[model samples]
Target: MTDSYDRVAVVTGADSGIGKATAVLLAEHGFDVGITYHEDEEGAWETAALVREAGKAAAVRRHDLTDPVRAAHVVDELAGELGGIGVLVNNAGTGSSEPLLGMDYERWRSVLSVDLDGPFLCAQRAARRMATEGRGGRIVNVTSVHEEYPRVGAGPYCAAKGGLKLLSRVLALELAVYGITVNTVAPGEIATPMTGQEDRVPRAGSRPGYPIPRPGDAREVAAVIAFIASPAASYMTGSSVFVDGGMVTMGPQAAGALQSGDWR
Candidate 1:
């Protein structure tokens, strides 16, 4: 899949939250973007507008990542629409608030399908295209702080992200022969609609357990992802980058390891 679009990037779940910020940031950095969202057409259009505002081409797709075939096809579809793809950001994911014992089997499956299977399929599809293109590519997975440690009431989420972290390393090694770089970006307490705090900036006391004094902004995480997708990160792969404002490094005590929800 090749197109006239230069430096095109594919960002899943770009309708809102960190995905929205990632798409817009990639555009600002001279990448035409193909954004995907599930059940949020309006939000997808809004994100596309941001990409266009940055003087880059934008395309939107409604993606349901539960099916492996469909998950992979979205990347191909978006790459076709955008002309080509140079970077792939697997930012689409879902979490379960129910504890493990209370969580039904369907709920567990839903979380894992979208968070793990979907990204794996998407990465495989995107990697093949990049390798075949012979121009090298960037693959960045947007994981979570749970990837490093357990989160209360979020067993499925933690499992999926932890799996993805390891998957990034495997992809990095497998794709290295093709000059493709794969990495994971783990974020903590980001201000987004997902956290139900889109209207306000992350404050120091918002997440009292965090030592940073403020919740992280979506843009902060996006910036780090953009760097990993850039040529500047050519030498990095099989590594995990934390955008948690020192939350992960602070250990469980200082960061309130027992707390769940947005603080994680």
Candidate 2:
């Protein structure tokens, strides 16, 4: 496997949440970062500033996963500007709240487009570059605990994440010859804007249903991603690492204890 050795990393949806945290942490780990934001240009710049504070170079770009084909080009653009991509973190994603029966086809497609198609295309771009450069790299896809479990109102989300998990495994097998490692980081409920808990400390709240009983911090998830992107993780690939605070383990127990149909 290739040693990361102060290389470049590209993180999507980096305007906030796990993406932002991962970008900053990677910079601290001797990597220059390329950040992509969907709607928050200011937040992207803020993340860039944090990377700069880490004494590493940072580049910001607007990435719309809805237009995945064109959006994937941003990977090349960032790689060109930052030298080359040594790590590709496919963290940009969208989720759905409507049930399978109530949701329209458009909504389902939207979630799949951003959550699955976008990552596939972005990974393709980054992988091609890595293969050509002849240096091993890392491809970390930020999925959710739903990848292995199910949620009542998140059919599309679960489907997309589940598909991404399998896709990562396939990529891992195919890319092994290139010395590139591919893995998935599956998180549970996180205290981020996406979860309606932006800038809030997870310890301030409580989740009786969860094993850890509180939401996870973005940095906690980022820490794992940083490790997977590092040279230390060279031997690990096609693995799904759970940063879910044991949430996935409590499904049967939590379900058995529910008092009402309110869970539906």
Candidate 3:
């Protein structure tokens, strides 16, 4: 039997963290991968090496998704290099936590540029390429738990992520005609270099608020993404898959509920 991902996939911010994990996983699943990095060409190369190790073709490129023109060029180049793009993973993002009262317009806009606008532009370009190629595609936006719920001091991150959720839905609805599926994969606290390792334990210990009672791993999130980007997920689109281990369902009072409610 032939694999569903014999084509190609482009994963942005693939230098490290969940982006890196997803890129590696997809490559392992028989998809040639285009790995994009901002300033970390070495990291991108490392990811490419892993893709090559998976017996898949790999292309490493530099892209600053915050710049629309450059981002478009990056997509065109990746499609050219990879032969064609079968999947687009908008996983490039950064976040900062600060009180809304002290937030500057520049910082807020920066967050939106990376977390929201970047994905939309990349997805639009990739979707157009897929539509023009007359072959269906998958677009997965690596969003966050804050996409639906708000957290303290993370106003900008929350705003951008929330916007991305709707963007994914809108694209999903419109792209359905083109046989292209669009969806969001929202993850909770996962242990990644970006999440500050020294503080990871403390953050995870607070997971009494999480129904799973434990933090997740990058590989776990990667697996979820790989599935979403596969042919098996054909009927799934315009949806946000929460890989948060049931944290979103419990809300902030989850800890209180767990502490006071039945053990069974």
Candidate 4:
């Protein structure tokens, strides 16, 4: 295997939020980025412009993770345009807010397919290419705090993210031989379109329930991803890093201070 990989990265869902920040940060870190968007071609172009502004090459494409088979090919397409992929950030995802009983099979399946199945297929394709080229690579799956903690109304989202965390671990173990590291970055409530907080900056006292007492910024989550994809994290793999502003640590405290059963 090659000792060092190429400085090329493919980030899905780069049109906005964590994906966009990650792509730009990676570009600033001396990587040529391949950006993909679902229905935000304009936003993707904006991200591409920022990448080029950072003095790196940027390639944009439309990637619909709902169609996992076709979407996974976007990896190859970007890799072809960028020479090779040294990093794959599986950041495209969807979520559901209805209770299990209220959700139809279609809703549940849609979340599972995009949040879990899409990453699996995309990782498979990227890993195959990395292995064939004999260059080590990095795979970062952007999950959620729900990956470990359940939410009352997000049954399908939790299930998919939880499954993805385990899948990342297995991939880390299997891909280690090829010098590919797989890890998951689980974030709490961030100011992103997914959280209905797009273009909003998190204030210090915004979330009193959280230990940090505020929503996280997309850039904050992206920083950790950039670190894991860099050579500095060479010894890390199969780990789940939580950029959740201590939200995961507040479960017991929150439960103890609950004033009512209204939480249910």
Model 4 TM: 0.98
What's model 3's lDDT at 208? 62
- Using lDDT, give the best candidate's number: 4
Q: Estimate each model's TM-score.
A: 0.92, 0.98, 0.90, 0.98
lDDT tens string, model 1, 1-264? 122223999999999989999999999999999999999899999999989989999998889977756768989999999888889999998887877878889889888999999999999999888888888889999999998888778999999999999999999999988888899999998888887787356766766666786889998999999999998888899999888877777784764556566653
Ranking by lDDT: 4, 2, 1, 3
Of candidates 2 and 1, the better by TM-score: 2
lDDT of 3 by residue, 38-93 (tens): 98888889999999999999998888866855675787798898899989999988
Candidate models: Cα lDDT each = 0.88, 0.93, 0.85, 0.94
Cα lDDT of model 4 by residue, 121-157, tens digit: 9999999998888879899999999989999989989
Considering summed lDDT, which 10 consecutive residues are worst modelled in model 1? 1-10
| Model 1 Cα shift for residue 55 (angstroms) | 1.0
Record all residue pairs in model 2 with backbone atoms less than 3 Å apart, i.e. clashing.
none
Tell me the deviation in Å of residue 240 in model 4.
0.2
Q: Native-vs-model 3 lDDT?
A: 0.85
